[model samples]
Structures are given as C-alpha cells and as structure tokens.
Target chain A: MQIETGELINITDKGNNLFHLIIKADKIADKALPGQFIQVYCSEGESYDPLLPRPFSLFRIEKEKGCLELVFRVVGRGTSWLSKRHTGSSLKLLGPLGRGFTDPREFSRVLIFAGGIGMPPLFSVAEVSKEVDFTLFYGARSQGELIFLERWQQMTDQIFLATDDGSAGQQGNIVELASSLLDSGSADFYYACGPRPMLKAVKRLMAKLKIPGELSLEERMACGVGACLGCVCRTTSGYARVCTEGPVFAAEEVVFNE
Target chain B: MNDPRLIVKVGQFSLKNPVLTASGTFGFAREYNRLFPVSALGGIAAKGLTVQPRAGNPPPRLVETPSGLINAIGLQNPGLTAFLQQELPFLRELGTAVIVNIAGFTIDEFAHLASVLDGETGITALEVNISCPNVKKGGMAFGIHPEAAARVTRTVREATSLPVWVKLSPNVTAITEIAQAVEEAGADAITLINTLPGMAIDIKNRRPVLGNISGGLSGPAVKPVALHHLWQVYKAVKIPIVGMGGISTPEDALEFIMAGATAVAVGTAMFHDPYTPLKIINGLSGYLDVEQVGRVEDLIGIAHKKDGLD
Candidate 1:
C-alpha cells in the first residue's frame, strides 16, 4: 500500500444524499482492485478533531485515466467534511489496501447482491468483468436510495431490484427476491455486500442451496492496516481483522454475531 | 553548519532520536514500514505481549471521542513464543532500537518474559507494562499501587540484565509516588502515562460502545494530563522518562522533552496518520535549527529550571 495525494477531479451528487467522487491518484488507481478500499484523510491540515482516517471502498478504478472513484454517503463528521471538499483540493489517501474479491472471470455465471451503499464495490465487479455473465440483485430502502441504477442496468446481463416501499422492482428485501428467483445450480458463484441482517440471511440461503460465495464485511477501522486490530469480525477461524484479512471473505468462513 | 544533535541517552542506552512509536499502537512495526523507512526513528516498542495468545476483547473495540479514541484491545498479541520466532527476526533488521513491552497477569509471568528475552541480540531494553488499563488483571492492578508496582519492577530487574523501564499509569492518585517506588526498586528508567481509563456509551443502543465496557483513552485529549504527570515524575526521580500520551506534532513532543522526558512515544496519533513520528523527527530538527540549540538533550527539563518564570 502507498500514501499518495490525489487531486479531486470531479464530484457528482448521485441524489438522495449519495455522492460519487473521482480522485486523480495514479499509484492507487493502478494498484486498487474490485473490493479493496482507500483510507481518506478527512482533516483539512493539522487539525486532530476528527482524529482517524475514514475508509471507503473503491467504487470504480479508472486506471487508464489515472483516477479512482468512491461513492459515499454523509453519515458522520468525517464524511461531512469530505462532502464539502472542492474539486481542486488535494486528498491524502492510503490504499489499494485490504484483500479484494476473487477474479469474476474464474466463474462462468456470477450472482451479485448489493444493499444500498454496499453497491460501490460490487458495482466495480460488474463494471470490470464484461466477459462474465452476471445476474444482480440490488436493494435499497426505497427507489430514492437506489444509486447507479442506469449504470447497473447497462452493465449486468440480468438485473433485479428490491425496495422496501415497493416504489421500484420487487416489494420485499433483496434476500427475499434472490431466494424466490434462485434455485440449485442457478449460478456457479455468488457475491454479496450489504447490511448484516441481509448478509446473515443470504449466508443461510447460500448454505441451503449449497452455492459457494464471498461476502464483503464492514467495521469501524483505525490504522486501516492489520496492526491495530480495531476492525475485526468473527469468522470460523477466529476474529479476523476486516481491514487486512478482508473486507471480503468466503461466505462459509464468516460467523455473524447476534 | 552541522545537524543539531538528536541523540538521547535513556539510562545506559542511547537512542538515535527522541521519537519512539508507542506500544499497542504500533504492532510489530511491520504495517508502517510499508509506508516509510522504519529505521529513521529512535526506537520501536512492539505490542504488549502475554504468556498465551489472546483473542482480545469483543468487537466494536474502538470508539472516537471528541479528539480522542477509546480502545479496549485488551492487549491482544501473538504471545511470547510467537514474538521470538516470528516478529523478533524482522525487527532486528530494521536498524533501530527494539524495546519489547511485556504485560503479565502475574509477577512470575513478567520475570519469565524478561529472562527469556534478556540475551536476545536486537533488543535494547525491557519496558515493563505495569500500566495497561485494558486488561482485567495484573496490568493496572500492579500499576496503581506503589508497593505492588515496585515488586513487579524488582522482579523483572532481578530476572534480566537489560535496562528495565517501568511504564506507569496516569490513573493513579500519586504518579510520583509510584515512579519513586519503581526507581528505588531498581528500575533503570521510566515510561510515563499509559492511557487513562475511559468509556463511551452508544446512546441509541443504550449500551457501552466498547466490548470490554471501558477502554483506555488516548489522543490529543490526554496531552495535558500526560505532560503534567511527566513533569511531576521528572522532579521526583532521576531516572530518564519516556513521556507519551496524545503526542502528535513536533510541538507536542517538544513539550514532553521540556517537561524532562529524554524520549516520547507517539500512540493514538499514529492511527490518525502513520507518518506522525517521521514528521515529528523532521520538525524537531527544524525547531532546534530555528532556536539555535545545539542539542535536543540540552533542552530536556528546561521548563523545570527555577530561573524560568518562577
């Protein structure tokens, strides 16, 4: 991993409080993978009020243009400060950190599940693997919360969306939609990134169907490296750091906490 | 025309500089080495080690307060045997001082660890962690009491020939009393101000944020407390002090040095920016040049000089 200062090239309001930021970081963009993330130093300069760097997964890696894109929502102080940054401002970034997803080309048919903000990394998977046949199950709280709808529709061979309010595709959650649509041998491999409840439900369903898959996990992090042991999740082996051991892990390896 | 002298002598051992990475914050020095050269710093203290591999506390182990972070990592480490076989060889090649911080649940555990690590080639000193607030037993328990603190120090001192620096807790009523007791009990030097005990509640969840319920507080919020304690300890003992807590910038490190610390460790601030120690090293050289000071050691305890504003 490398620390590089990247200029903010573009910032787009994806609507409903979501934003897409593209940074010009040649080294990070060149090294970053589908599910890997970058730690964004949010403090303006020497200020230590917001004391830790915030982690954001790679939404799109524009290597040819020497740029990296991140999709984030304004949740707390760090992201709030990040959202207000101007395009010309420099952003200090540490990345291409963490283990990312496996190569999608390894499987003939892939199934993807994305929940709200979790869509960024999975969206990257769909964007890069054009040769693989992908079926996507994307969900959000409502039609307004859904982002990159057009891009996702264009990228995947088949797209399924679920909204809690029934204002979009399916009326229920994404896991319910996936369960109703998929059966044994529906796909060779599956991938998911979402809220814990959804991931837990998906893990159970995938086990019942006996399909191998990977899950992207999230935790509050410091150091954004393996050192601190701050961001860890319970796995079959033990508590593994989410920053280094993964933001991605085998579906069966993860043991969700109650 | 020559570079200002950055070398600092702590007891019999001399460090290349005054900036050392704090234990628990810097895990084995492998992570930050990927970003910058680790050999430039004065010293590195590996994570606190125990007799057995600990899984540590449960998740949600960290919470960020105003300008501080509360963490109950519960001294998670690879245990003593793993360190010798796995981490020590890598540390030896770093071309810097390696100070091992040992945490024990009992006095024998502390002595055993020191004895085993005594003749190790790369290790410069043994830092007895009597001040860790996260663990359930034998950490701050031995630290808060002067007699108990001295007993731990005495045992480690008797077990090893290496210079023993006892790290003291800031949570005590009389930090100087504990400092004096350890010094009298044969401590070669002192490392002051392990994190103060703190807790954060998740208001919506109506529960404690950390899995251990309470954790140790570190970062900028504890700077004043750490410096005050360091100043008091400096006056009470002749042993050199390694002052640390909320030290992020060069200015902060200078404050600790002026307050009579031969060295300072950067802890929580490293989590904010891994380059913090390197930045402070450069900043110190710049400060010395501008101030016309010939040596950093000359400035140690200058704030305590009776001629200054007293």
Candidate 2:
C-alpha cells in the first residue's frame, strides 16, 4: 500500500480552478470517507513563495484508475500554481484526512444546503445520497459562481437555487430559502456547508425553527488531519477540530460565534 | 548498493533519516495513520505547541492567493501538557521519531517547556519555532531578529538535553545572520522558511478576506524564495539544514537537498494532497533508482553555481 512520491501523478486538470488530481494512492482512497479531506502539493518542480502545502476536500475518486480527485478553488498561490499545472505533472499528497460527514442512511428526506466553494463537500454527500429523497438547496453570490449545478441536477430529484445578487434563481441567502422550504414540512434531515457567516446564520435559523440538522464547518486548517489543531471550533462538548472530529457536526452540538 | 537511507545525529538522538514533516503541516503522527503508516516517515515535527493551550485567531484565518496561501492560525494547539497526555502516547506507539515544536510567549515559557520535556523518552528532539507572525510583542517571533532567535535557542538549549532545531522564518532581511546566531547559540539544525507575510481582499465585500488582515503565505509560490534562503544560509552555517517552502513533489524535495539541505520538509502541499510526504519519499526512491545513484545523500549541494550568473 506504500507508494513512492514519484508514483503520485496528476491525471486531469478539471478547469475552473479545480483539478482531478490522481496520486496513484489506493490505500488512502479506500479508507477515505465522504466529508474527509486531503493535503495536496500541487507544484512539483517549483517552490513558490509560500512553503507549505494546501489542504483540500476529496471531491471524487476513481478507484479503478487508482486516482483521487480533488475539487478545489484556486484561491491563492497554492491553487493558482495548481491551476496552471497541465497533465502528467506529479504531486505530493497526504490524505483522506479529517472526520467525514455522517452517513445519510438514517434519514429519509435529506436537505443539503451548499454555498459557493462549500458545494464540494455537499456534492459528495449528495452523491452518496442517491437512493434517498434529498433536496439540495444551493446558493451563490451570483449565477456565475454557481458550479456543478447541472451535474447535481441530473443526479438528485430536486434542486433549489438561490443567489445573493439574484442573478439566477430565487434571490436571497440560502438560509432564507431553506427556511421557507422547511416551513413547507418537506425536509426531514438537513446537512449544510458554506461561508462561516452563512453557517452561523444557518445555525441560528435552525435554532429558531427547531430543525434537526448537521453542519459541515470549514475553518482555516494547517494540517487537514488533526495535527496542528488550527481548525478548532467551539462546540457544546468542548473544543473540537474541524479537520479531525468534523467538517461535519450536529447543529445542536456546535456553538457558533453569536 | 549504497543505502538510500539517511541516519542523522542531532544532539544525543539519531534520526533514521534527516527528512521530517514540517511543523503545522503534519498533525501528531496519528492523523495520517489511516492513510499511511506514521512509521514510514523519518520523523513527525508536530504543530507549534505553546506553554498553555491557545484558541488561535478569529475566523478567516486562511486565504489562498496566487501560488500560495496566507494564514494566521495563531498557534492553536492543545497546549504541551494536553498533547503529552492525549497525543504523545499514540505517537510513541507509531514507531516514528517524534519532534516537538515549541512556540513560547516569553523567555520563561520557552525555558519552562524545555525543562518540562527534558529527558522525555518518546520525543526524539525539539524544534524551536521562533517565527510565527500572528502573535504580538515577544511573539512577532524570535526568528525575525538575530539576538532574539539566539536567546530563544540558547534558553531552550540550556533547558533540555534534546537536540534543538531552530526553525527560521523567511520574513527577515538577513537570514544568514539569524542562521549563524542560532548555530552559535547551540542549535543542532535549522528549519528554513516559515510562511511569508501576506494579505488578500474579497472584492465583493471590498475588505480584507481573513478576519486578521495579514497572514503567513505558504505553498509553491514560496519555493524559489525558500530554496534561495536555504542555499544562502547553507553557505553561511555548518549545521545541517532542513529546507522547506512549497515543496510539493519528490523533485522539489530533491532540489532542497541539492541546495545543501541535509533533508527536506513538506508543508502546504499537505493541504492539496494529504499523502504528499509519502509520495515525495516514493518519488525520491524511484528517482535515485532511475538515475543509478547510489546514495540519496550524494545529491546534497550539487547545484553548480555558475559564477558570473549570480
């Protein structure tokens, strides 16, 4: 199961600042769960300005190809370097880290609230929830920011779209749309991911509406695994790592910044 | 048939290989266990641990820009005592060398931490991080100033019998001076190039992206800068160097070694690829075999510096 660093390969550059990077790492992939993430070294031959690797969520994986796919935003120097990379580039990856989302087997009607870059994790959850009746309430700052909508639309039976600028579907925060849908008494269980402010507002709305939900939190992380404890969040139990204990947490268990 | 393996001696302990995971990148050797064996690595340099546990900075501690990332993680850790009780036991069992990295707010805190961990059986060494930018006052990082770096190194050296590796920050004007100071103050080795200082803006919000205005930048963007520092400092000091900065592949790791780094460390790459360290190791081995090179150490400082080119 051990692979030499040279064996890690980049299979595809799925454009739009996203990459379908393959590491030739099977053991790590086999053990990887839905909500967990991986740390990838994008630039092989060049050492740019920042000397550290960036952590990303495992977007999709092809076990047959022995490759792992990462859906990442080219936010900074790390990703910008990654975005420029072409095929046949080699990468250094450490992964399948952080505690993933809880399984959706228990819930009947699942609602996934995703925003912008947060859609990656929610996408994974949606893929796993194929057999279940789930409604993905997706939102973005503008219509152009809405990614993976068509592919998700094809997979799930119901998809709701919202944007802050109303360049697309129902305009407003995703929480507003989600709350209205919740009022209709259709959603049984909900999972959400998005900006911190959005997630905070969601947590508050969930409390007001008394909805049972699980939130996948995203905090700035050093080591996507639990090493640095850089991505700690205050929860009802105690301080827990977003990378280790969860990017996913029960709405009731976490204590957001009020 | 020379061994591609490397065994480096730092203080009283001997590391199987000079290679190690940089602090803040690899968790406590346990997080990667499910994917790769912790024992596979030469050692695990844990995240920066302070005297007391810290909550770290506010939200938006990290922002990705260009070929790098800016972070002000603020040294969020479980504190040394908690790490010793909760995480150390598992790390010790992984059969990998454990290097504890310390960041202190004051001279006494650093001294006290070293004293507390002195003669610890599980830990192989201590890496003093004098370069975190998030903290205020004494913690703008001891790595920024030569005297400050030396003082922290000397204080920690006097407190513990373990090998001390002083991790240098790249934000300084003269890296060589700081490197020399750490060496003269009894540091066993040096970890070059922490994240560089940076900032980002969210156009929609028309304000700073991160809650903290400035953050430390890491990833491929800093590799060239890191390599330059390593090369320059290598010529300035006799102590072994651990070079890291945007090292995302085996070739990158090799570049560091050839630039006079005794070993290389993996950092921001872990964010993009979690198995980066193992991949780099595998790559190095394959590369050595393909090149028909006997020992990996022979590649150290092999970069031919053309005189007039500089």
Candidate 3:
C-alpha cells in the first residue's frame, strides 16, 4: 500500500448517478488486484471538510497503461465532491490495500453475486480470470442501475440479472433468483458483494448448499490501513478489520449482525 | 546557518522534535512505518494497552461527522503479555521515543501495568490514559473526577520510575481541577485532551451510528475544545503539556506550542493523511527558518507571556 497521486485521465457517465473514473497511477495500478480498494481523498489540497478519505474498490486495473478505474455513485458529500472533478485533475489515492478474493482460476466452477455498486470488485474477479467458467447473478434497483450490462454480456452467456421493480431479468431479488437456479446446478465455489441483506441471504444459501465462498464487506473506515481498527466486521474468531483482514472474507467466517 | 533545531524537552527527556503521534491514532508505529520512516518524529505513544486483551466494541465503530470522526474503539489491544513479547521489541528498534499509553479497569491494574513496564528499555515514558471515553469501567470514569484522576496518577507514579504523563479527557466539568490534582500527585507531564464525548444518529434506522451508541469525537471539529482545555490546564499546571486533539498541520502544532504546550501530538488527522506527522515536522522546521527562531523550545507558551502588549 502506497499513496500515489493519480491524474484523472477520463470520466464516463455510466448513468443513474453512477460514474466510471480512470486515473493514471502507475504504482497503484501495478500493485492492485481484484477486490482490493483505494482510499480517495475527496477534497483538494489542505481541505479537511470531509476529513476522511473514502474507500473505493479497484473496479479495473490497467497495468500496461498504468491506469486504475473506480466506479462510484454520488451518495453523499464525498462522492458528490468526487463527481464534480473534471478530467486532467489529480486524485490522491492510498491503495491497493486489503486482502483480495481468492484467485478465481483456483476454482473450476465459480459463482459471482453483485448488487448495485458491489459489481466492481466482483467484475474485477471475472476480468482477471477469464478462462474460468463463471455464473454471474447481478441485481440492481432497476434497468438503469444495471450498469455495464454489455460488458458483462461480452464476458459470459450465463449472466442473470434482477431488479427490484421487475424492470429487468427477474423480479424481487437476485438472491432468490440465484437460489432457484442453483437447485439443479452446482458451483465449486462462490463470491458475493452487495447490500448486507443480499450478502446475508447469499450466506444463508451457501450454507444450505454447503458450498464454500467469500463475501466482500464494506464499512465506514477511518485509517484505510489497520491502525485505527475502525472498520471491523464480526467474524467467527472475533472482530477483524475490513481494511486489512478483509473487504473480503470467507462467507462462513463472517457473523453478520442482525 | 544550519537548519533550525526542532528538538524540545518534555519533562526529563529531550525529543528530537516537538511532534508526536497521538496514542490510539498511530497504533504501535508499525502501520505508519509502511508509509514513511516513523523515526523522523519526536515520539510515538502506542495504542492504549490493557492488562488483558480487549475485543473492543462491535462494528459501526466509526462515524464521520462534519470535519470530525466519532469512534468507540473501546481500547482493543493485544494485552500486556503480547506487548512485551510481540510489539515492544519492534517499537524498541524504531529509533524513536516510545511512550506506551496504558489503560486499566482499576487503580491496581494501572499500577500493575506501570510496574511491569518500569525497567523496559527504549520506552521514554508512561502515558497513563485515564481519558479514554469509550470503555464503561475504568477509562474516563477515573478521568472525569479530580480525586480519582489524581489517585490513578499517584499510583502509577509510584509504580514506575519513568516519567508519567496523564492524558486528560475533555468531557469534564473543570479540566484544570484534574490537571492540578494530577500535577500534585507526581505527574511529570500532562497530555490533554483526549477525544470529546460525542455521538451521531442514523436517521433512517432511527438509531445511534456507533456500535457503542456514543463515542469520543476527534478531528478538526474538536480542535477548539481541545485548545480551550489545554489553555486552561497550561495555566493550572507547572509540568509540561503534550497538546493534542485535531492537530494535523504545522500551524496546528504551532498553535498548541504557542498556547503553552511543550509538544503537540497529531491524532485524527493521521487518518486523513498518514504522512501528517512528518509533514508537521518539516513544516515546523520551515516555520522556524522563516521566523528566524533558534529552536522550537524558544516558542513554547509564548502566547502566555506578557510582552509589550501588557
């Protein structure tokens, strides 16, 4: 993990308040991996209004061009400030921090679940392990929120989608869709990233099916490194820092709070 | 001339500079060492240690407020035995002064911690943390009251031969009363102020944001409160003061020194920028050169002095 100033090379409006940012940061891109994240300083120099840096998963790592991609939505002040930045500006990033997902190539059959902004890290997993067979179950609020659909379709034919309003593939939720599909199908391993409810439901499904998997977690972080112990998630062992021990953990190891 | 001297003395020991990373913020100096050489700083107070391992509070441990962060880490540490066996050796070799911050449930626990660390090499001093606001039993429970605060300070003072710096809490009625009480009890220096008790609510959930319900507030938000308390305590106590709370930049550190602090500690700002302490050290050097000051020691409590204005 190093602090690198990455120049904003490009910005794409993925629509529905979601943005795709590409930064030219050689060192950070060189070190980044799937499921790892970078802490972006929202404000310009010497400003502490939004005092803490916001953590973002490495949506895409283009090492050859020394570029890193971030996918974020304008949810609050920090992301709002991030959205207003123009191309050619610079962002201070501290990354590629935290333990990432298990190498996708290690598993013969892989299942991926992504919800809303949670798609980035899992998308990274699919991008890195192209040779591995993957079944993606993606859910969003509606059709507009289902970002990068063409990209996922290009990657695999086994893509399944769900939207809350039934404006997309399946109605209700992605967890139920994935659960029903898995009744006749089997995967060696699974990976999930999304809202806590989705993750919890996936965890339950994985437990019921007796399939081992990993879940990427999120929390409000202070020190992106483990120094502060601010972003910890309860685990079977005890509390583990999401900044270090995870942003990803074995599904079974996590004890989700009710 | 050569670079302006950044060195300053706190109690009996001399620090290489007037900048120290606040306890709980810097960890054991191991984490920040990955970003920069921690030895460049004046000193480091390791995270608060207890007699036994603490799991701390549950998740949602932190919440970002306006220009501040509220955290209820609850002093989760690797316990005393692990510190001696695993952490201290690494700290001893950091080539910087290591001030171990200890928290305890009772006065005896405080004494026990001090006694165990008494002859430990490479430790510059013992920062008795009676100011932590997260824990239910010992932390600020002893800190809010003068007699209790003085009792903890006196017990630790007797247990160890090292310099004792009592870290004070801002969530008190009269901070000076506790400061003076600790001074009278044999505290060599005072570290004020710990995070001010504060909370945030999740409006959607209609619940408190932090898992601990309420946590101590730190960062730029508490700067004024910390400075006010430090200014008051500086007048009440003769011992040196290690001023902290929302200290991030060289200007902030200079403000603390001018307000009567011998040294200043960078706390919540380190979360925003890990290189903050190093930046402050260089900034201090640059400030001294620009002002034509000889040493950082020359500026201590300068604001409190009655000059031509008086």
Give lDDT tens digits, candidate 1, residues A1-258: 989999999998878778899999999999989999999998977799799999999889999999999999898899989988888999999998999999999999889999989989998887777999999999999998888888887886499999999999899899999999899789988889999999999999988988899999999899998888989889999899999999999999999877
Write candidate 2's Cα lDDT for A36-78 as tens digits. Answer: 7776655555444444556777666556676566666777767
Model 3, position B58: C-alpha lDDT score: 90
User: CAPRI verdict on model 1?
Assistant: high
Off by over 4 Å in 3: A183-185, B1-4, B308-310
Off by over 4 Å in 2: A1-188, A193-201, A218-223, A227-241, A254-258, B1-5, B11-13, B249-251, B272-310
Please give the range of 10 consecutive residues that has the lowest summed lDDT in model 1 chain B.
Answer: B1-10
- Ten residues in sequence with the least summed lDDT for candidate 2 chain B: B1-10
Candidate 3 chain B: 10-residue stretch with minimal lDDT: B1-10
Check candidate 3 and list the clashing pairs: none
TM-score of chain A of 2: 0.87
Q: What lDDT does candidate 1 reach at residue A1? A: 95
The weakest ten consecutive residues by lDDT in model 2 chain A span: A1-10
- Give the C-alpha lDDT of model 2: 0.76
